[model samples]
Target: MSAPPSPSSPRPRPRRPGRAHGPGHLIGAYGLLALTALLVLIFSLALPRTFPTLDTVDSILSNQSIPAVLALAAMVPIVTGAFDLSIGYGLGLTHVTVLQLVVHDGWPWPLACLAVIVGGAVVGVLNGVIVVFGRIDSFIATLGTGSMMYAVTGWITDGGRIVPGPQGLPAAFTDLYDSTFLGLPVPAFYVLALAVVLWTVLERLPLGRYLYVVGSNPRAADLVGIPTRRYTVYAFTTSGLIVGFAGVLLAAQQQIGNPSVGLDYLLPAFVGALLGSTAIKPGRPNAIGTVVAVAVLAVGLTGIGQLGADFWTVPLFYGGTLLLAVGLAGYAARRRMRTGAFAARGSPTVPPRSPSSSTQDGGTAGTTP
Candidate 1:
């Protein structure tokens, strides 16, 4: 083997400073922490016995799991410098398809469940192909695809709800959402498990580095022999698969296929993903940050909903959070760019030339202006 790199030889760059560890990062971490604590404290004080109880925590987790899943799903595309707008519509389609397959077609519940999940995966793959091979902009492509999914959902459900069978459905399947694990609901456990696996892969694996490079500079990644298209397609496909799985969870939890329910989930999911970029791994989408973001929304909204807040207020909160998150991400990205610019300027090895040094005659060569 060749000798190891010498100290005098050029070294690879040090790890890039993650946006989450920079100045003012603590502000977000502490802000979210304080907000979470304050919300719990106030709700405890205001509602007394009801708000601080175990049942309340269970309720929040149970209700929040579906949105959390969708948020995590949304985060995948954002990592690849894109967004999956079809998830909300995909949720609607998946649920409706599941209901029709089982309740209407009289298929066995196990087979029906399998079919729906496969359908969701197929949808995801189609999304990836469309975006990658078609050379379409992710936002516009997903928008169109989302619209098509909405139409499919409407067609499937006949624009009405698909109620689950009271007796025909398996108890074990229905209980998927209701069961408890370690005194917490099963859905919460699912979220934790999924987040852990995803975070581990994205943060610790080589694939994540490839994804980051492609997201930051696709052309550069391509020049360096990274398969930019392949990774981009994988990102979209994976995003679709998660969203599809989230749909299964929603069907289990709701016990109905309501076409209208899915769109309501879209805003909150996007909000969680966007807001997540402002924390943990700021300026980049990360699993833990996304989970924390969803938790923040869940806690805040749960408190608000308990306080008898108007129904419209939640959407407004989500929209406002999205705006704030976008602003924060923009600021972080700009700061990173400025940091790099200044670092390049400050380096002693990259010295600036004097005005007199460019002369054709050697008289002024190496002279200081």
Candidate 2:
């Protein structure tokens, strides 16, 4: 038989690159965005007079801003591999606190807003402590804390609304949520600004990288000397602060403290956060993706409503979309892990010892004898 090829000889080229750049990759990256655009096109064609108007755009922007903010809040914790279930409850409590201070105690709107924001930070710190120091599971701890917050909200509001005095909320206060800037609602601008800031922090900053590392593998992060617990707490605290700001905006928009409204946002916030993972940068929570996901939901819901869909249809759509988003997120995450594993396995193997080299060594020894 012919001698085996030398180990140093060139081998056949790999049929595929080490990395895949196929349709599946593109689909994972831009599928949601493509769907969003397609939905807009369909809705515009179906309801040319209504769906494509500035009014619809403004309504979607204005109405979805709070959920967008809350979704971002939820996203911060998720980046560190934790969840903050208390966001909705904390939102209700914080806004109600704002209203109680302003309408009931005659505190100025600005000062009341300041107090609520600080209180939100405090609640966030509390959550971080409970989760990090107390060694409680984030989901369960936040859920319990959230329930307590709802109870506090009920106690403060006494199951009643807190309406502003006859003078009405300061025009400036309401304008925060009501006014337009560059033809877009101020809240829309707020959403954009927040997303930009978060994107910068999470994508450009070292802290963001640390958070991602911790989320990806806490044990690996710890092995690398990263203070995972401290960062985790920081993530939770940041989430709280953002949620608190959303509460302020909610107060401005509603102009009344409705203790029941916060929970309405929780599911939608989660849906946006989870769906966000499958876009922008697939398989991880990202700020821009969260904003885009929220926009998709707003567009879809608006389109359905314009089609004369019943009120129940709205919840059904949200519920179904939420389920789809969760499944996709989980699938994407597992897919990423599998891809990494395969890449590791397919890395260049060590060359086998050549038979020609062994035969040459044996001949040289025999000749010497």
Candidate 3:
């Protein structure tokens, strides 16, 4: 018989993260970000004068700011394993209401903005109720609520654009989007600020931990004494709040209410959130990752726009990238299947309800549904 090995003798060690996955790991973590830089390089070289200019940079940052914020807004509910398709519709309703109050009812812009934001939170609560209590799939529930919200948007606008009267929107209100900060557009700062806030809440707070638990595996979370239903509601509510804030920015930027505007943002928002899940922290959605995803998209769109591509190419690009992101996310998940490898996820394991339990550390089946 073969001798049994001594306890002190060497054991087969689990492969360390970088060594286990090698180039695959690095590419999964940073491929999209690297692509962003590469796109800039290629475009700058191809269209030296126009593509590399500060004016182009500023315009891309400014124009893409709202979309980035909207992407962040869309990401909140996704953490709780729920989807809020209503954000675009909610955004439409809130912004039109803002203009209606400011222009027609003569309400102060600040008051109007506040009211819309609160209304958004309420809408989120409604979405949560429908999803959690009503037991409808989140996709269906949010879509239904979103359709209703869109209808309300048209009703308030009376099927026409909501234009300001002679006095126009308070210059201060318009400046919310138009002003500059640190030599860059204020809206860009708004995106950065929102991203930081989300990162803190989702990555560094107990509330975020609970929401992630609920989303990653509601059944497991329930077993572990996490308030799965409550956190799901909170996730929806947070998303609604963010969407409302985005509407305020949209109002300031457009300075005119166009009901059709919200629908256009929905695709890009999802694209960023989904595509972002494949980079910087693949297989899970994150704030900084989402921001980087949006930047990649912004760079690509801007470069293509300058390249004079046909208009239809915009939707084609979004749709294609989304498919690619989904596939890449799946591949990343497969590559990381041995997640129990301590070094792979880069977070310490804790009991499910622990204060620092990152979603990535969920030792449960609480990943994407």
Candidate 4:
């Protein structure tokens, strides 16, 4: 004899949508992953020489590493139903901070890096405060902060590139991005490690569940005694910290501070984050899905480049993908909530889903992403 789910437990860890039988279920669960594989296979067949080589793999991994980190960074506050548009400018500001400290001021590379990363965390705290206390929308708050960061970045570089003398940067600092580990680009590992850590926090920890509750329904979360404000701030802080670290990596890779580089990453990061919410664990912005989304984008971009697509194609793809991901994410979220309610209460008829509904009491799969 088995015990039933107690109604007292508000969250019952709804089964994954893929658990259902049928091709549709399987496709819905893994369409993105399949698309990635299919893209690779098609490209390998079509562009035999350039597309199927280690150099291509290395290039994709190396180039996309920073964007992937930014995507993950964007994904964090999203889990709590908030956005942090400041990341792009913040990334620019932090990396430029590193360049200003290390190259111009001649600070020790390690110390410069430490200061920049810490500064990122501080900025995160500020963003959280602005959103929670200042009562501004996260999008608006982050956008303003991001603009300020861009201004500061321009000030640091005086609207030009920051380049070290012909002596170049310290070898050790350069190695941070250039070195390889376990036959993969080291930066890729950073993305992987960050994703793994986030996955552990959001999928396996109580703190993560609390954040989900906050994202799903703030009023309900408060009624249940969760500190929604504090947790929202925590999410922003974590995002800031990751953005800071990514800035360090960006600095290492470019070895020059270009004031305008950061804005370029803004679109792709959101594309990956929103698109990501539709895979791995559909309807929620999970770390694994974000990673998979990054991979797909990388593959698609690489394939497009190898195929000699026009310059405008990249931005076109990104914009189209962003719109598609947002729609899919919203739809997936609503369906998941409805289906989850059906499964949890064992009610034959699923309830109409509301935009503000929360997930089960103890579960973590709620977010409009």
Q: Per-residue alpha-carbon lDDT of model 4 for 1-369, expressed as tens digits?
A: 334445675553445432344675577679999999999999999999999999999999999999999999999999999999999999899898999999889999999999999999999999999999999999999999999999989888998999899999999999999999989899999999999999999999999999888998999999999999999999999999999999999999999998989889999999999999999888889998998999999999999999999999999999999999999999888877777666656634333333333233344454343
Candidate 3 vs 4: which has more TM-score: 4
Comparing 2 with 3 on TM-score, the higher-scoring candidate is 2
Candidate 2 segments exceeding 4 Å error: 1-20, 347-369
Each prediction's Cα lDDT score?
0.80, 0.89, 0.87, 0.90
Report how far residue 245 has shifted in candidate 3, in Å: 0.4
Off by over 4 Å in 1: 1-23, 28-30, 166-168, 340-369
Clashes of 4: 4
Q: For candidate 3, which ten residues in a row score worst on lDDT?
A: 350-359
- Candidate 3 lDDT over 315-363, as tens digits, reads 9999999898778767765555555354656743332333223323453
| All candidates: TM-score | 0.85, 0.88, 0.87, 0.88
- Scored by lDDT, model 3 comes in at 0.87
lDDT of 2 by residue, 1-369 (tens): 576556688865543323545688789878888989999999999999999999999999999999999999999999999999999998899888888998889888899898888888889999999999999999999999999999999999999999987888788888989999998898999999999999999999999999999999999999999999999989999999998899999999999999999999999999999999888877889999999999899999999999998899878988999899989988888887777677657756434434554474453222221
Clashing pairs in 1: none
Residue pairs that clash (backbone atoms under 3 angstroms), model 3? 80-215, 216-366, 217-366
- Candidate with the greatest lDDT versus the true structure: 4
lDDT per residue as tens, model 1, 1-369: 344334475635544433234446677544555667788898899988678989889998999999999999888878888888999999888877777887789877677778777777778778878887899998889989999999989898888888865675567767777789888999998899889988987889999888888888899999999998888888877787787778777778778889878898999998888887767665677888888888888888888888899999988888898898788877766666665666555433423334443342243457543
Off by over 4 Å in 3: 1-21, 341-369
